[model samples]
Target: MAQMIAPVASLLFSVVLLLLGHGLQMTIVPLASLSLQFEGFMIGLAASAYFVGFVAGAIITPHVVVRAGHIRGFAVMVSSMSAAALLHPLVAEAEAWILFRFITGFCISGLYLIIESWLNEFADNSNRGLIMSVYIVVNYAAFTCGQLMATLTGPESFHLFAIASIIISVAVMPVAMTKAAQPAPIAIVKLDLRKVFKTSQAAIISALVIGMVVGSHISFAPIYAVQKGYDAMTQAPVFAAMLGLGGVISQWPLGRFSDRVDRRLVLMVISILGIFASISITLLDQADFLVFLIVGALIGAATQPAYSLAAAHGYDHASENGYVRMAAGLLVAFGLGSSIGPVVTSVLMQYVDIDALFLFPAVLLAVLVVYLAIRVMHKDAPVAENKDSFDFASTSATLGGVVSPELLNEEDRYVVVPDSWEPSEPEEDDTEEAASVEATDDADPTSADEAVAEDPLETKAKASA
Candidate 1:
């Protein structure tokens, strides 16, 4: 195990520090903004801006990495992220914070790209699952710790922001000094929206709904804790940490359960649970800290796994080689929903009541429950033999499409062979196989849209004929 992980250990170390700082920032931002007298709508707008930058960075950062190279790009992003963290306390205005949040979002997206793609490159089929599991565990643990760290100081003070900045700045040291080989430049995955929708309406729609629900939950949950009389010093952080903790613990069990039954059915169950949890929280007005903490975990467990289930459901219907494209489309839909969720939730909180925070997600979860029911009625479950195994996916802002090992099939894989590698003696068939490969390489590459599945109805008609 140690031998297998040695090659990418430095990258994982960097991830630990990076996520720690990021987790702190996510917890602090909304609380700080509220303390600065920013309206709920402005807080939501700021949250929306960050996600907008996140989606934009996912699209544009590849080009930057391609031009600047991974190590250099990683450094630049780390520095920018650190600066953004410090600027939040410096400026103290809602408008300035919005721009700072956007910058942080953009840098974070790029940083995830560099780190995740490097991990992807380092992995092979033999140990890929183990490596990914390790990454996921580390990712969640670090982020959760960071959230808890918010309790170290008051959000109104600049100390917490400084601590976050210091952590982010320190994140650069391991990667910069490491002697590990740089991974290949990241590829831009083109999204096929129409094909994705046709592949599985359940997946695409669930992605959007889950995105909105989770996005609002993450951005505003701290504020909700404050309104419920939880002090930012201890209670609020514990509430946020419980959410992360629940997500980490519940993913595997829920994911494995979905592997046996219809994933759509599992999604409906999750949506129902989310609604129940949200309503429970709303009803428990000014509950004790322990009760609020338990409710936060329940809601997290209910909603956090929806994205993974939806993606797994899509894979059940997607073509063998189209996994990457399918994931890209779902990611875009999720990003759009995340960007819009906070704004809508904020408006409700501003004009309606503080409880709208939970009410908003409850309503979205209800819509998803209705949608999933309709889908279950309209479409038969994919045969067990045809189902794709569930792989854990996070609802947090990340480059999930790149990190998922299942998304890249052998035929469509992007690997970078090392310069030290050598070919073995060739067999008689090698000459012909080499010639075939040469010819295939010389042919024009297929456009991204052309690689996705055709219309489902047209495919069914052709199959019937």
Candidate 2:
């Protein structure tokens, strides 16, 4: 327990630093882009660099960590991100910023890999749920705080960048100080494009749209708020509040209930409502708090689920052996969608105004609605009645919380390995637990806890969440 203290503290600080860095950088990026007289398309290009780089890094990160080892890989990546943040004001050119953003993305991927793999290692199977939930909460809290930091300072000078550096630099101390066992090297999972493509077209399209929506929301919402009559100071915090609170409030009922029902209808309903919210926000130029908060929350609740909706929808069409490959493919697709969303929306803002961003999502969502409507008509629509609610298990209580990958997609990422999880390599103890879990999963498909005893990570999840 004492040994676990430092690493857990480090993980907590990681949440804080990530959110703080994100909020500070996000507030700075767009304001700087406009000051430099960058076009919406160019701004899009710059923002896309992050996701583009992240995707590339994710592709290679697992292998690099395996070779260099966890601590070294984490140290290198965090330093890279920190260095990039520190360089932002110095290199201060649009192209330079884009290049820097790409580097930052590359660095953070290793950070994510290290942290997630660490959690995986720390948590045995029984407590995985609790551990993951706590992690998700911490993550959500950090992101919200990151969004809120835009109010603290602006891109007018180096103060924000300095603050970003402080956060990044501080992160290193926690990691370096921890005495926890460093994780073993891991092999990167190489995605098979040909196989994925042949399996589900929905994964491709859904990934694209999911990426577009989420990527733009994070990078541009501050500017979008500014255009909506908000000062830059007010912009970041409010947008953060919307996204941070929105998903937590809606996840439980929506995800849980959907488990027992058909999800296609839910997807259509969410998209339609999102379209309405996106379009409706344009009608409000008021200085009211309730309105923006309401709109932000609604938009968040309405759209955040799209990623899961699309992923689950695609998974419905896949074979049992295809879950992991499908997840990778969907992640790539979502990344691409995120990469493109900002530019297109930003360009739309040019012809009209900031209102274009909201309206732009509305239009794209409308297109999705039509497509799904057609699918529903053709009877090829995604069915939501299945219990794929693992990844989306957290309900309204998710607001200051984190959601775990295990809860989100267990069977896909880590299989239950009873033999590997024992305190001692007692093969007899392991086999007994395994036989027990198999019986549980067969009896209660929705119960993730039954399989917990057979896995060590599950035990860790309970402690953390």
Candidate 3:
């Protein structure tokens, strides 16, 4: 672990700082927006806007890196995010907040791309697994700490925004000072949703549903906590931390079990569990914050692994050569679902009850459980030989993170298939010639042997047929 950490320590430090500020803002924004008298739907729209930009950034940021190189791109993204963070407090209107959130999301996507790909460049097969594990640990730890930071300042003040901006600004120092050379340029990922869906319907559907569930949970759970009459300082951070803790503890075991069985079966079980957990949270007495915390952790445990399982399942069907494309497609699908989730949940809460936020996920998970149950009946699991080994993946990961060569097994490294290597259909004339040859062989074996000797092409065509 020390050996793995030595090579990318600077990059990891930058990631920790980046996630800390980003994590703090994740909760602070929704809470602050609520304090400013923004309605539930507006807050949801603001959150959805970030994901909208996230999807755009994942698709377009590679070109930014290609043009500017990793270090320069990293610097630019960090600066942009810092500026966006400061802008949030200056603007009071929901529309302005939405725009700033989108910018922040866009910059964050690029920043994560730069950091993850940089780490990938420094890792080799021997240390890649350890490196990725440490990365996940850092991710969970930093974000949880960030949520804790929210306790230091109330959402209505400027101090929290300043703190978020300063933290992001400080994150730039480690990367800028590092001696590491720029990594290879980011590759342009081509996404064909049709091809991706054909690859694994269960994986794609699960990605979308998980996106909706997580998006709502992250964006609105703080609001729900506030509605329950708990202060942001204690209840909100604890709520967020419990979710992170649940995810951190559950992912590895669930991922390992997924490797040994049909991933869809694991997914089906998760969906069913998530349905129960969501319903439990919705019906539980909100006055007892402890109970909410416990059930929220259960919700996290049930929902958090869905994305990773879905991704692994997708990879089981994807050709080794198309791993990057498949991963990118899943990210896009998840992003689309995330963009829709919060708005719908918020509207549900507006027209119904604040608890409808939890109910929204419950209904979605129920549908997913039913869908997976039906899918299980119709589709046999992929042959074990064809399955990809399960690796823990984060929903927060950018495209570069998902497709990093260092994270893949040696056999699964990105490969380019030649455009000219497509299979060709046999021509009618060739088929007819082969038929004639077969007829001759049936009629007279000796004559057929002589005919083959006369025409090598006939023999080759006959073999092809």
Candidate 4:
């Protein structure tokens, strides 16, 4: 285990570099758009253009991996990033950068494919969970730091662009120089909505909402900070930290707490907490540093687990194959939501105060919470008829379909809830395979505390966080 992990730890930089490079690069695009006299709609089109690339790359990443192999594939992907970032400052107009952004997004999707596929192939079944958990943690941490890099120079400075390039260049060193055996090619996850929707509509809705909310923040949070009076440096860390710290503080408890209760209920509480956080930010009389911290912490906590909650809720009623298919479909919905979220949120920020940044998410959460509440409460209101448990063993589609979050079996199908969760004895496969697999990669806390489902937005004073 130690030897395998040591090698993994070295290769882990691929994820770090991938994250930092993308994080730093993305922070500047929207900021640049605003400075360039681009309209809100154009800026959004620029922002969402990346998703088109992201989705396309994901669809074909498998072929690239299979044909080229991991090391070669990874190198090819990172080189594109270098090209995209260095050429960024060279582009004279917003329109050109939009094309660059699309290329960057497309390349980055392959990058994730290479890394995730590597993890899937190399991680001993027993060790994959731990390796993956660490991989996610590193990606999250580096991303936050990359965002912090935004603060290194003002949005308009060429320094941010240069730094973004340098990060990508350095990303090549770890894997390119390594002697590790090349892993197998990547697999394209074909997300069929008809199949997934047949399993559960709630899943689709949950995936969309989560994507929109998260995508909105990444695309515009820096701009929001600039509006709130912080410079780029402060903005970078705060934005990245908000999301990173949100996962840091919440993943464990939410994972654990979710196991003990109805996950939908947990999501509702988180949503309300999220609303309260942003609402307080909106109403604050002054924009203090502490204000950002407090608001970020709260909002992050509420929003971070959103997908998971939606996933758990939707999975409660999903079939085994449905869980796998739905997971991938969720990624698609997430991509769609994320792609659209920025455009909608950016317009609100451009037309309204920066404080209006929260309005998009707040409104979404508010409606979702109310609808979910009513659905659960009403005797025959739609959307609450299933009772499946969350299954972490299957590969799940999250964050736009490059790879599923949980690396469960891509081939086998099984029910979501534990057989014990049902009134009957455990299924044979569930009984033997589950125990063996759980014993293998048991450290992923997401496994320990997931439950089957079931939100509100409390109003607050308006001030920017």
Identify the leading candidate in terms of lDDT.
Answer: 1
Give the local distance difference test score of model 4: 0.64
Candidate 2 has a TM-score of 0.80
**Tens digit per residue, CA lDDT, model 4, 1-465:** 576678776678767876787777877767766666677767777777787678667666666755666677778888887888877677757778778878887888777766665665566557766776776667667776777677777667777888888888788789888887654333334457887766656657767886778777766766666666666555544664575576556755675566566666677788788777778777766467776767777777788667766666555655644555565666677778878887788778778767767877988888778866765565231243454433332222233342333434424342122111212344666877777766654566344233211000010000000
| Evaluation by lDDT, superior candidate among 2 and 3 | 3
TM-score of each: 0.87, 0.80, 0.85, 0.80
Q: Model 1 residue 370 lDDT?
A: 93
Q: Which has the greatest TM-score?
A: 1
Off by over 4 Å in 1: 393-404, 407-465
What are the runs in model 3 whose C-alpha is more than 4 Å off? 393-465
The number of clashing residue pairs in each candidate reads 0, 48, 0, 20
Clashing pairs in 1: none
Candidate 3 lDDT tens digits, 1-465 = 687699799888998898899888887998898889898889889989888887677667767866666777888899999999998888788989889988887887777666666766776667766876787778778888888888887887799999999999999899899998665555455567887788888878988888888788888888888887788766886787777677667877988898889988888898788888877776766458888888888988888777778878887887855666577677777787788999999999888999888888988988888888899899988988887677663332322124422232223334221111112345567877777766766688576345323321100000000
lDDT of each: 0.76, 0.64, 0.74, 0.64
The runs of at least 3 residues in candidate 4 whose Cα sits more than 4 Å from the true structure, single-residue gaps closed, are 235-237, 378-465
lDDT of 2 at 329: 71
**Best of the two (1, 2) by TM-score:** 1
TM-score of candidate 3 relative to the true fold: 0.85
lDDT of 1 by residue, 173-264 (tens): 99999887665445566667898798888888988888888778888988889988889778787798887688667777888898899989
